[model samples]
Target chain A: MNKTVNQKAWFLVLPVFVVVAFSAIVPLMTVVNYSVQDTFGNNQFFWNGVGWFQELLDPSTELGGRFFDALWRNLAFSAVILAIEIPLGIVVALSMPRHGWTVAFSLVVMALPLLIPWNVVGTIWQVFARGDIGLLGWVVNHLGVAYNYVLDPASAWITIVVMDVWHWTSLVALLCYAGLKSIPDAYYQAARIDGASRLAVFTTIQLPKMRRVLLIAVLLRFMDSFMIYTEPFVLTGGGPGNATTYVSIDLVKLALGQFDLGKAAAMSIVYNLVILAVCWVFYTVMVNADAEKKEVEA
Target chain B: MARIVLDELAHSYKPGPKGPQDYALKRIDHVWRQGGAYALLGPSGCGKTTLLNIISGLVVPTEGRILFDDRDVTRLPTEARNIAQVFQFPVVYDTMTVRENLAFPLKNRRVEASVVRRRVEEIARLLGLSRVLDRRANNLTADMKQKISLGRGLVRPDVAAILFDEPLTVIDPHLKWQLRSTLKEIHRELDLTMIYVTHDQTEALTFADEVVVMYDGAVVQTGTPDALFERPEHTFVGHFIGSPGMNVLPCTVEGTTARVDGQTIPLAGAYPDLPQGRRIELGVRPEFTTLAAKGAGLPVRVKRIDDLGRVRIARVDLGGRPFAATVPEGVAVDGDEASVILDPTRVHIYADGHLVAALPAGATAA
Candidate 1:
């Protein structure tokens, strides 16, 4: 038996390829090119091979030490915000008004924070957390806690974390709300007939139904928090002693602030790979879970 | 295990209903006998589910009280009512195994572990879910999930009654019969007062010893399957039950004869004084009406003959009114002209949709 090979299909895809090349591939290729070469002033470039990558990986060196510190800081920040946001989002979702005029009103209110620009969110928090002028900072200081995000490391971390939570937790809550709404009313009726308590209903029915959306939420929040730069950058400017200098902040400092092109490009490539790798894991897990779910339904 | 009673029960969704039209469920006074298998049969929006929910205490009726074994449980919540209800769609805890799903209600009520285990095993065995007891409830066919729902409802040994709200709607066609028979068998063994609600007449007739036929928010007739088939109390019941339903033709009655279109139909008994100015009608099942010679009985135009496998039915026009009557075997219908022979004893008279009882011999309408 012989089958015809449809080479003409490739032509059908050419337009998309061209658009992607101009939008993503070319810029990525430029970054890849810079990662392997050193550039001095006047656009003069020379082959640096893997020298920047080696230096970046070596913790004993200044560059490597700073990279590790920012890496750890980024991971910790992601972890802290996720721990705070996920449960808070679920609680908010559960407490949302179920019906009547209040449901639409509450939905609009919940969506307000997510509509703001990221940098705008950062700026709002920056001005809002000033000890002398801002309401939150002034109230805290007046309550005698000596709150000053500009000077204190702990205070800066709190402000950045809180800002991220305020800006993004709504996304998670909205996703969970959608999941909750999709559930048929029969399940709750059956639960009532089965004499299930409210807690049991949440654990067995609501939580299990929300699992898929919750996974998506975790993956999204994890990715966004890992690469978080705009909010913290605008709010603290990498902070008092590099305490809030996450990987993206430090990468921006190296690439544009210090003009270390080779090191910055190498760091970016690694950063992209890390995100891709994490996203790949999440995608694989989600696909496999979806297949399993389909199989069960079938 | 307990006799349930609905005493003057009525429900209206609005706060203050001014008339009968506003009530979702009209006033109902019924006594569900202990250990009886009953069915609530009706079309959609006939308020059968509203009645069931009231029984299960999910919705408190706007008026009247409910009694279980002489104890009033009118305002009780579902959990405190000690009744189990299975919904139209299957409801099982997706994360739990079939065993866990079956055991949920018992565990919720704090039944002893050993008792819960034994009851779960028993219910699983009865539902044919024993083989899949360890499998996740979600990882099953819709029929199996529905069986799990049934098992959960049955596992509670002390439930006052079990209500099923069109529970087999999602089951496969072949599986529906199997599940229905299994439900009947469970009802037999458990001997619990069970009320099955369904729109399909076959399911209701086959499952219930006593079928309560409802229409327009009221119970029109409550009788055995045979009784409903033989005599329908209301015109709606006559039109709703049976395969082809009873033939209801508008007529005018005087003494013992019913005049329809201009032809007269003799009545089996007298319907004297059928009240002033009410619509009169005559009803007879297709089973008792048959086709014959063109001039033997009531003249009809043979419109169509439906060969329903075992027996053939003739769709005919009686004085411009469409009617159905059985066509006997080997009766060759050559032309549109024919006659329908209706069994005089089986014919019933109705006034304004309600049956008009025949006056006894030597008696006068009071």
Candidate 2:
């Protein structure tokens, strides 16, 4: 077969390249430039070359110590939220109404939290969980438990995780619900005829059908939870001795509050790379599993 | 392994069905002898699937009861009924191997592992799926998946009956014949009561020992395929069973003679009292009605001749009404004019779409 080489096709891709350059590549390059250089006011810059990266990597130093703490904290938060959210989302989806007007009502209610602004969610939870006059706080206090997010680090962590779950689990549920809806009625009927128990049907039919949607849900929740900022910042402000100060919040503190330009830029690059690497690992593992199954079939 | 009986079963999708028309399935009473293969044949929207679901306990009848060997199971759930059903589309667990798919029913019922394994092997061999028993069901072809569905149903030894609801609708045309034969072979070998539902006449007629023909939510006729072809109990059956359906013509009956458009055709039996003020018609299949030259019998205008590979069918106009009659080979048509020769014994009288069973031979009509 003869292949045709067309140089003009590159022109068609040039427009997209230009848009991406301005939108992403250019800003990322600026951050890279800042990471390798030191700047003192009046726009004066001196080459630091690898110094900031080296300092960030060594946890013994003050900057590196804070960065490692925040990184572990962010990873823990993502893990905790994912462990709670995925199964909870699936259970919520399974219990949702399959038909009637109530389906619409429940869907709208599930979507309401997702529609609320991130900072607004934080603010609402902040007040709702207060120890003073807030409903949750007053209720918990009256119930003989002392629960104050402002004073207790564990309470602050609980509040943020709960807040994130409330805000984002709906996206996972809605996706799962769509997956559940796509299954033909025949499968259920057949399962019934086969004398499969409810649990068996769920494991064999529902879970297999929901595989793709659940993959998407896990990836999205992992990425979003890892990079979480506004909600926690508004709710706890990484307070109570930096107990809940995740990486993004700490990064903001370094760049904007402390004005540690080179260190912050370096941290930002490392954070972006970590997310990219984690996502790549997830994709590669899933794709390899699928390929292995195909090879076994062949 | 059980004789199934539907005693006055009926169903309606509505909460309160005000009249018969409101019912999706009209009243039906049927007795399926144990080990007999039956086919519920009907066009789309004829409630064949509704009746099948009711038998399998997927649907509860609005009235009356179903019995399995004299056991009343009217309100029983599907799992309790011990009947397997293969749906219109293949329903296999996508992640499971073909062996697991076949063994699922037995395992679900908590059968012994050795028994489940043996049953699964027998069913896989019967379905010509022995080689692919370890392959994932999701990767198999649609027909193979469908066979897996059938295998799951067959794996259970305690199953009372197996119901198939248009299971071949998704199969390729060439594979349909192969799968159909496999089903027949399984039925013969297992001696299981299998009720196959389909709209295709060929599938119903070929697969079933006795075909129950449904029309508009009612069984119009239930008999052997030959009986259905030879003597249709209703005008709809006569029309539905044949390739070119039975020709029904508006007519007036006077004793043994029926007058159609002022021309008389002889009848085998007398119909003196069909009904008063009701539409009476003559029903005769084109296979029994032959086309001939103009001077042979009742005159008709030959509209066209369709050569159906083996037999040529003459589409004709009889007194301004369209009609179909078989044109025998070597009887070449020279012009538009022709005559149709009706077999007297094959002619039937219908009143308001139902057959008027001819008064016993040589008996006077009351």
Candidate 3:
């Protein structure tokens, strides 16, 4: 038997390439144009080559002052979100019923929060965390704990984290649930026959089987957390001080608040590059882990 | 190994069975000997699988007492019952290596690592799975994965029994034969109590020493293959246990003989007393029915012929009811007026859905 290679399949992908180039490349070119040039009131420009990037990288310069801090905070936030959401999601999914009307009911209820728009989630939490009238704040105060989210840095960070958990953990849970549901009941029966305890079943059978979806959940949560804006901005406004000021919030403050187009454009590019680099690392790690798993089996 | 017993077992999914018709599995009293091979054979929805699951402790009987060597275990969980079960589909751990899948049961029981390794290796060799021991089970073919599932069930030696619920339905036809023989060999080597449930007559007939034929949630007959064939206690057993099934012709009995379609076939013994004008049916296996020349036997019209290599199965019309007869190749019959003869001693008469005659011993058509 002889192998046949077909080259015409490239035609099927041409439309996608054109669409991506138009959407991504065009905006990226515009950002590059704004980054290196200085502009006055009326479209006047001057080439300031690599100066903004250097300033943003320099620790001593005022322009670079909060940039590195937000970057570090974004990284830490993404890490913590992944660490918390993945496990919590898995626990909820494991606890779900395996069959019947209860399974369908749980799935629908769990998926409800994921369908809500992100900005609306921020608004809901903003009103829900208010000190006097808010249910959570009133309950905490009634228990004799001094609770003020907008005034305390730790409280602000906690509120943002809780808000994020409430909004996005459902997505992870739903994905993990789908993964778990796809597994045949035969595996559980086999585990039972093998005399595997509940813990062993979870660790050996459930966790490893859910690895692919777990990777996807981690990647999605990481990318979204790294670029988080609306929820934290509305909840704490990256305050009390810069405790919850993630990179996206800082970027918006730089570009729109101060209107320093050159510096903000440079910051935007750096910020986008950071997100791209981190996402690439995550994607690479996941792909490499899958490849290594396949290699060992082979 | 332990002898298992079910005493007064009856199950109903609802609150209570108002009558016998509401019960999924009627009150069953039976015993399974230690180290014996048995099969529960029935069609779909016959409660064979339900009974097997009950024995495995996966499903609790609604009203019953299950005894394992005189110790009651009816309410015990599946894990506490010490039984291994192979489901209809392959259920190996996709992420674990084949070796890990086999070792899971042994490790769960806190078996020593060295012993676990030795036992896993032994079972892998037995199932022809040694080559793929280190490979992830998900990558294996369906049949190989099913073999791993079977291996997992057999890996634990201390289990009271191994229950198989239609384990060969997913297997390919050619590989099914090999697996069945391998199972038989394993039974001999391990001396394990095995209860295999299947809907296939051939598998049950060849695999088990004793076959329990069930219908409508009750065992119609339990006997050796020969006994089941020679003396079926219920009409369902006679119809179910044979290939092409048994042909049951409507008939009315008068004294010690029955008239079938206008011809008289002799009865073996006195008929059971029944109300006059009650419906009766006579059953005879297709293999025992002989096709003779025209005018020498009960007339039948040849509808179609299925020549299956060694034998020919002729579909015939007898009194407008379709019936099948197996005849040896090279038997010529007139297409218009073919006559088929039912062996007198092999004929079974059924009244009110129960057998009424005991056929003479060693009765065979010449």
Candidate 4:
């Protein structure tokens, strides 16, 4: 084949560049503008020169302490959600009916929690976990456990974690179910012919085949749990003395509640960078493992 | 090692079957002799795979019992039945190395580590996978992966039988012959009863000791390749087994001679007292049917002659029915002036598409 270079292809891609400049680039530039400068009323702005960033980074400063606390809370929340969801999802996916009318019924049922609006999930849990009027609240109180989500930090954390689990476990389960469904029956048949036990079949055939889907599940759950806002906001409102004020909730409190735009923008950049860095590390490790495996195969 | 027997085995994928078409395998009673290689030759949807699955115990027949030697194993699971099956597609444990894949069954059965190692090494060497023993099984090409699948079956020498269900379909065309020959060699060395299923006649004929021809979910004929070629019991077998197949022409049979559109052909053996309402036909191989001088035999209009180097295949029309005659290169056909004469020794009379007359012991001339 002879090579023919064409410059006119740039005309085809011009619209996508213009769209990205408007939608993503302009807003990001606004964030960059806010992060570097201090603004007092009437659109008056002055350069702060990384002062907000330094304050946000230092644990000694009040602002930095609060930011660190929220960041760690976000990390812990993501960790807990992943630990609970991945295995629970795998089990649910495995136990779901593999074929027939029951599969459709079960899939619709599993998707129910996900279909509910985020704030609605919070409101539902808020009413459902009340210490007085709510059924769950009354039952727990009557059982003498003294459960109170609005007042107690522990109960608030438990309530939010349970709410998140109930809201998002279905996503993980659906992904794993798709993974399980993709495995060919011949693998299982061969396992049976090999006299493999149930656990052996799962470990040798099913689990390995599900690896790629599980990676996607982990990445999705990690990012979603870290950026969580509405459900927890509506549920706890960051109450019980900041016990569950994740970085996003704290950033919202700073930017909108106190109107600290510079501090909030600085925190936003740090939060995004943290997520990007962590996710990048994760993505690289997984991709390199896949590539090396392919090399061995080649 | 075991003489696998199917005693009146029938399977219907549908429940509450009403007619013969409902059954995937309809009441097949056959015995595969111990340590013999057999090929189940059939077109797709002819229940060859169903029968293989029954023998492997992957599928339990809806009717009848299977026996391994003397013990009835109808309800036994595939593992308990101790059979290996290489499927149509290559299946390998993606995470395991080639050696581990071969050793998987032995390890699952709790074979000692030393023995498993020895057996894995032996099988790997035999399969020409010794260099790739450490490579991941899933990383290999299709042919190599298929070899690993075969090696997995070959590693376990104690298995009663090994069933291959079109295992070579994914293989590259040039490698198919080599892989088939490898399978044949493995079968020769191992004492396992092997039943290979394929729709390709050449693959079946080249691989097995006896070929079992199936049609419409029924076992039509079971014979050696020579028997299948020379004396196909059913017309389906006659049409299926050979290149260009045997020509079956509707005929009127009266006593020892059969007539096709006023052209008479003598039968080598008498088909006396054929049943009423049965359609009589004459079946003869294309190789045995010759083109004689015009007006001396069944007058045919020569349509085409394909010169295949060593022999010429003359395509002719006999009384408006297409016929094929394989003739030596020396024999030339004059266009539009051809007549075909089927060799009496090779010709067989059929009653209602079933072979009625078998070639007699000492018949030399037509």
Residue-wise C-alpha lDDT for candidate 3, range A178-244, written one tens digit per residue: 8898777767766766778999888877887788898899889989998999988878888888888
Superposition error at A185 for model 4 (Å) = 1.3
Question: What's model 3's TM-score?
Answer: 0.92
Task: Put the candidates in DockQ order, highest first.
Answer: 1, 4, 2, 3
Instruction: Write one digit per residue (lDDT tens) for candidate 4, span A48-165.
Output: 9899999999999989999999999989999999999999999999899988999999999999998999999999999999988999889999999989998999999889888889
Question: What tier of docking accuracy does candidate 4 attain?
Answer: medium
Query: What TM-score does candidate 4 reach?
Result: 0.94
Clashing pairs in 4: none
B1-366: candidate 1 lDDT, tens digit per residue = 799999999999889999999999999999999999999999999999999999998899999999999999999898888799989999989989998999999999898999998989988889899899998899898989988887888888778799999999988899899989999898889889999999999999999999999998999999999989988999998999987989999998877778888888877778886877888889999999999988888999999999889889999999888899999877888789999888978999999999988865335433
First chain TM-score, candidate 3: 0.90
Worst 10 residues of 4 chain B by lDDT: B357-366
Pairs with backbone N, CA or C atoms under 3 Å apart (clashes), candidate 2: none
What range of 10 consecutive residues in model 2 chain B has the weakest lDDT sum? B357-366
Can you give the TM-score per candidate against the true fold? 0.96, 0.96, 0.92, 0.94
- Candidate 1 whole-model C-alpha lDDT, 0 to 1: 0.91
Model 3's CAPRI class? acceptable
Worst 10 residues of 3 chain B by lDDT: B357-366
Best by lDDT: 2
What clash pairs does model 3 have? Answer: A194-B105
Tens digit per residue, CA lDDT, model 3, B205-300: 999999998999998899998988877888898888887778888898766678877878776654646456656888888888877677767788
Let me know the DockQ for model 4: 0.72
